[model samples]
Target: MTGTDTPEWPRCGHTDSGERCRGRTVAAYPACLAHLDGTERTAYLASLTPGADLDHRGTPFTQSLLDELLAPLREPGSGRVRVGEAAFDEVRFTGDAELEGIDFGGFCSFASAVFDGGLYVQDACVGGDLRLSAAQVAGDAWFDDTEVKADAWFFKARIEGALRFCVRRIGGSAMFKGMMCGDAYFSGARMAGVTSFSEAVVDGEAAFDGVHFEQGADFTKTRIAGRACFDGARFLVNSARFDGADIGGDMPFTGACFEAEASFEETAIGGDLSFSGAQLAAGVDFRRAVFRRTARIGPLICPGRVDLSGAVFEAAVTLEAAAREVRCRQTRWARTAALRLRYARVDLSDAVLEFPVTVVGRSRPFVSPEGGVMAEPGLTGSRVRVTSVKGVDAAYLVLADVDLTGCLFVGTVHLDQLRLEGRCLLASPPPGPRWIRRRTLAEEQHWRAIRYGGGWTPAPSGVETYGPGVLAPVYRQLRKALEDGRNEPGAADFYYGEMEMRRHDAAVSRGERTLLRLYWVLSGYGLRAVRALTWLVLAMTATVLAMMLWGLPQAAPDPVSAGTADGRRITLTTTKPEPVNPEGSYAKRLSSARLEKSMRVVANSVIFRASGQDLTTTGTYMEMTARLIEPALLALAVLAVRSRVKR
Candidate 1:
């Protein structure tokens, strides 16, 4: 038989285009030499020698031959297949290529190898480097539960179906750079070495859920057309980088733990990027990253710095951290983007927030994009809680629109020179008052608390707190910001705060400092008109009482002795009206008249006017003091009222 027949004979089962081979088989064989059972098959089977350069290009592999080829690798530490240059290019498998549990002893290359079916390498051990670069896989590439002792490279490889490496342990570097494949699964995989997927393109979803990386991982320039997940993945040490990655779908990192530095710099995300319940122990960099959708990172434990400089959040960006160590510096939010930091302890010392920063509370009007009347935004819409904001730089820091009603500011903040679209609200909401007739004990207590103080104390001293004079700058800036926003009432409040701070600062001149304190004590630094009026009334009343107690001087008829020329004088006594008893009712009426005149004199002195009654000061010093103080009180009251009105 020449292995070529048209009669009733078995032909080679292997064909590139599914055309039956014309070559006949040997005795009792089902296929020709190319498939099996011929001189060529025998030579090919015998060529599978140990410790040799296995060149299997343009050849076909049967299950039995593959078994025999890997039989040596199956022995535990006994035999090695050291193919110095593994050439399996364009090789085909007649059946499923099962290389499971086979240990590769040296560098292996299957570049451009074609798998007609799935490639199963479950629990396989690569003793040295393994390269499947540019290999074309028709079915799933299963490397689950395998161990790669040396570098594992799949650069530029194309897998038409799913590629799984779940639960596999890679000891050395695992690189899939520039790989274009279907769904890529690496869930529960443990990589003790560097894992790189730079410039890779995945057509289907890419999952690395619960994977553990002992070293750094790089996914720079990767593009995922489907959903990408790293949920519960742990980066134990070194850096985990995802720079310049483009994710078309959701990229959730829920419950992920990063023990070292983690970076997503310059990445572009199309869907929601979530990190809820994630634990970040080291520094995280998201500089220049672009989020097309919302980026929610809440209820996380981040003890390290989170650099978000130059990052663009197209939608809302919500972050809630348990630790205040997270810093948001120079992060950019789009005009439509809403930033919420609920129940978080964070630092926005140098953060820049764009305009239209509205929250849920009081209603403020805003025109819709369709050019129609829309309900005003609310103040308490979303809450952003922070431990401190030391020196924040905002594009438009409209405190009114930047609803901080839900925020608890424990640190001193600087609000300087930022554009204001509306009012800036910083004061607490006013409590309702009770009418005098309907007030109860509880109502009275509430009123007392409001009138006296709320029992608030200064925040603890830390980096967020500035020393004595340092707060003056903050108040100054805040006043300027309020004035710029055209909130004169709010500006006046902050101006008083600024002046009060300067009064306490040692840097101020002694005279100015003393004057400020006096102003505050007398009339609340010209801010309390009621207090100024009360002091004026009290001073006038005291002067009136004193003048009443000490009677005014009555100019008696000037010495009534008729004086002659200087040499000799003759006395002519003037006739006196009938004398009255001093203790009699008439005498008492005269004394009352004197007292009334004294009261008028006191009132005239206080008003800075001459008394109509001819009354002289019985207590000259007291009168002079009254004259000086009454005018001062009047001036203070006028100034206080003017301030209240101007504000």
Candidate 2:
């Protein structure tokens, strides 16, 4: 009821719409019921009984009156205060409200409840839940510091400012689902039960730094328009999921620890996703996650596996961590930027990596059935890059099943220590004999025995079946790679391998093969200069031994003139044995000098050297054969030396 402006009793001095209220005061009160003082607040509150239907809506109560009104709710076994649809429209609370353990019978709403101070509701046991849906608070909401027993529901609740929660024990599930709010600080808060924010849109920064989820944290389909940080947060129990979450800004998960399964499947991140230093005890599935920008996942410690299959990244994505196993099958690393792995130990068994990708560091050993523990990692079907790879661990790389049919290599393709257990298919099928050599029936049976048996078998084919069939192409590529790197020694090794394969080719004629094998056995395919020199020494010794076997040739004794009875003189050849002299004799001395000259001539001729001495010609086929043999050996030796020096 409106009172006169100048009434005998004091009217409400509270201003509304820039004007004072015209309502009269209560009995013995200075102001109206809407604006009562603290001294008269108790008298007004005492008038109501325990079961009284209080309808103090729109009334401005002092801090003392509000405390006394809610005093009964703080006690145990106190009946519910039936404030039927009590409205607290635009109510300004001045002091900290300790409304713990408050029971409301009906839908009690403080829609526009403005708190100038903080709201402390520790261990609040409410029979009817405090559905403060769409409630507005001015100060921080402290539902945590004290163990809140209420199922904290903040559906569509808007805080005009910021809020923080402590490590409070929640009795039931706390849902901030679909709540539109400002900055939220959830540092060190442990929600002991189920927590959900499905479809909730946070307009300001949501910092869950160091927060622990004892159960599950479901943020499925949630949208965060600002920065969302979960740094150092721990998910101890159920799955920590952010499936289909759309993050508008950066989401830094640095140092976060997850004990259970964590999934970010189908999540769309507009900014960078940083998981640096994150520790995972269980597996994390990021399948189909779309990163609009870069993702830096490094310095991480994950003992469990990580599945990132089908993930797509628009920008660069680098993995610089150590984990037990990483599966990225069919993951699209980037659209344009490089996907570089530094110090990562990944098992890219069936992965499809985009071009311009590089890997550097040691990985798990690649085991082969035929060849025992091959300490290498395999990139089975990934595309080879020309300029991306640098300083990779070539010693432990496995490219057995890799196909380099169309790959163009610009730099060194180090395959010296590569494991090629599978068929080393380098190029496509060309127009040539499918099998390296003709496999006879006996050869085939022998190969089958080698395949099934434990030990080696003797094959009918001159060359072993697995000797050079698939290794030819591999040797070619290896030679090219080593040559590009300017490693001449390594290149020469592969070159020898290539030559050996050609020499063993069944298409090669027997004559050519005989020549090639002869050279190979004698001098290491003409690449070993020492072998040629050793053969030369043996040839010289053999020549000297043959000379010793046959007596030294003395120039045909000068035709001797015998005294003829007639005037004509006749030449006589002496075939008589001369007596041997113990010391010096003219015939013996002449024989020794001739032997020395003949030995020197034979030695020089065998080594393809010119000798000044000329021996008397003995017209015999043996002499001609000896001359041809020495020249041929000399030519082979020269070729061997040339090949080694040029190589």
Candidate 3:
């Protein structure tokens, strides 16, 4: 359908006739829709393309003269401008006018040009490169839904007002380096190749919602005074960098991905930052970046490290469902909300975690059997909650002055030195699982004797302080028990017996012995034996003195004697003095008379001190005295007393 074949469209008074028209009137008097008489049409078209002049000097560039172009289209009518089948390859727009919906049919270049008013190319299609490099737009520019067939270069362009490129797709590279826009919107735009906005400055919001970068993209050093949202964007190729960019508002990158390294190093974000569900094939570095509000990188996966070293989050930094091996070196979080790193494998080696921060992990079943390993020392001035860490080799693993009151390790927990003020449970073998039974003391001793050749040190002080000292004693007892057995028991039985003996020894050491006969005997008569020996010696000395005094005549004799008192009665006493010896003599003379009489008494005392054989002998003697001699003496003393009473 050609313009000429149609019927005559309504024409306004601004229409021109004859050769002055740029081309044949398309069955319409007013060749361009902007020349319509309505004020609304004029105003709307004025917003589309500013600085439009119909004539230059005395020559007409279009159908309407320059004076006629100045007149505004009146209200109650739609204003439109159509550039159909036109080759404005190098056209320069210099005046303030309107050219809405103007189509540039082929390659277009307004390079190094200036436009005093707004330029609207809404729904326009450029067949080739659209070079607006170094162009100056004094009013708001609208390129909404515009398609650039070839590479579009707007490098060093200055737009005094807002620039809109909403829903536009560029088939080739879109370079906007050093371009200054009052506000920019390229929402839902698809760039087939690289899109470079390096060093561009947007005074207002720059919205790139649902934008697709088919290849690489770079926004390095771009400054945006307003929000820079690339929500739901995808970078298909590598080398996607927004490094050193400064954003005045929130930079939400929800559901974004970078196939290669995503570098945001040194970027400053004035508002909240979000990168939910973002995936980076390589490392993502936000090192030394500053976020003015909450920055979230949740549910993201980076196959390589995610470095946030020296990055300052003015608010909380949340990292949920993070990938393995995240490096959060020297990150400073200003808000009270802890930087959550749940469900992540974090390598905070050499990291300085400040106070009011919490490093936590997900509460899930043990996914890794080996558990988490620390490659280096981790310093935590803040609290770290690691719940359900299964299969840890050490529960106090290299912890230094860390307050672990709330930390939980529900599986096999290991430690180096854990000074826990609160309670901590050691990981035990799970119930219903195959458990390796603990070795018995006998088994341990046998093993030790065989393996180490019966050499061992005493248990450490800490162990002795905390528990009963039984290891050595148990070991000895196990050796003795095994030696006494004719045949060695099986390993299991030996181990069981050894353990029982160990327990027994522990009890004995704790003074739980059933028979204390040896102790009782040693304590009871230990001093009494010495005292009895001393008394026996004293008695023997007294007896000796008595015998000596009786055997020997007294040195001092009594003064009065029986026959010496009166001498006058001596003659009568001599006749009655017959000796006892005379009776024996008379009996002997009669016949060989025989007579005999005998009386005997013996006293014995013995004391002995010895060990082993000699001790046995002394013990036997003491027992005999206790069981027989002592009792017999008591009976004898009783009988003697009874006989004396009878007498």
The Cα local distance difference test for each model comes to 0.62, 0.55, 0.50
Q: What range of 10 consecutive residues in model 2 has the weakest lDDT sum? A: 381-390
Q: Kindly report which residue stretches of model 1 are placed more than 4 angstroms away from their true locations once superposed.
A: 1-37, 43-107, 116-118, 337-355, 358-492, 497-524, 528-551, 555-614, 617-647
lDDT of 2 by residue, 535-626 (tens): 76666555544443332333333333434344575655555332222234445534555556556756666654546433333312223444
lDDT of 2 at 540: 59
Regions of model 3 farther than 4 Å from truth = 1-105, 277-282, 295-303, 334-337, 352-354, 364-647
Off by over 4 Å in 2: 1-146, 150-167, 176-182, 270-278, 335-344, 348-356, 362-471, 492-647
Q: Can you give the lDDT of residue 56 in candidate 1?
A: 47
> Which candidate has the top score in TM-score?
1
Candidate 1 per-residue lDDT over residues 379-436, each given as its tens digit = 1223233433444544444333333322332233445664434433343423554211
Clashing residue pairs for model 2: 376-396
Q: Write the per-residue lDDT of candidate 3 for residues 1-647, one digit (tens) a residue.
A: 12223223222234355423222221223443333347643544465332232211111233233224433321224333333123222223445534444445455565545566777666666767777787778888777777887788889888999888763778988999999989998878889978899999999999887888888789999999989888888888756788899999888777676777888888998876665555567767888888886555444445566677777777756554344355655555565334344233343322333334444443332121135321211222233333222233332222222222222222222222112222222222223423222223322333333334523222222221112233434333333433343322212233333333444443555443323322222221122233334444444443323223221121222233234435565522233221122222332323211110000001222222221111122323443343333333334334433322331
Q: Is candidate 1 or candidate 2 better by TM-score?
A: 1
Give me the displacement of residue 545 in model 3, in angstroms.
50
Clashes of each: 13, 1, 27
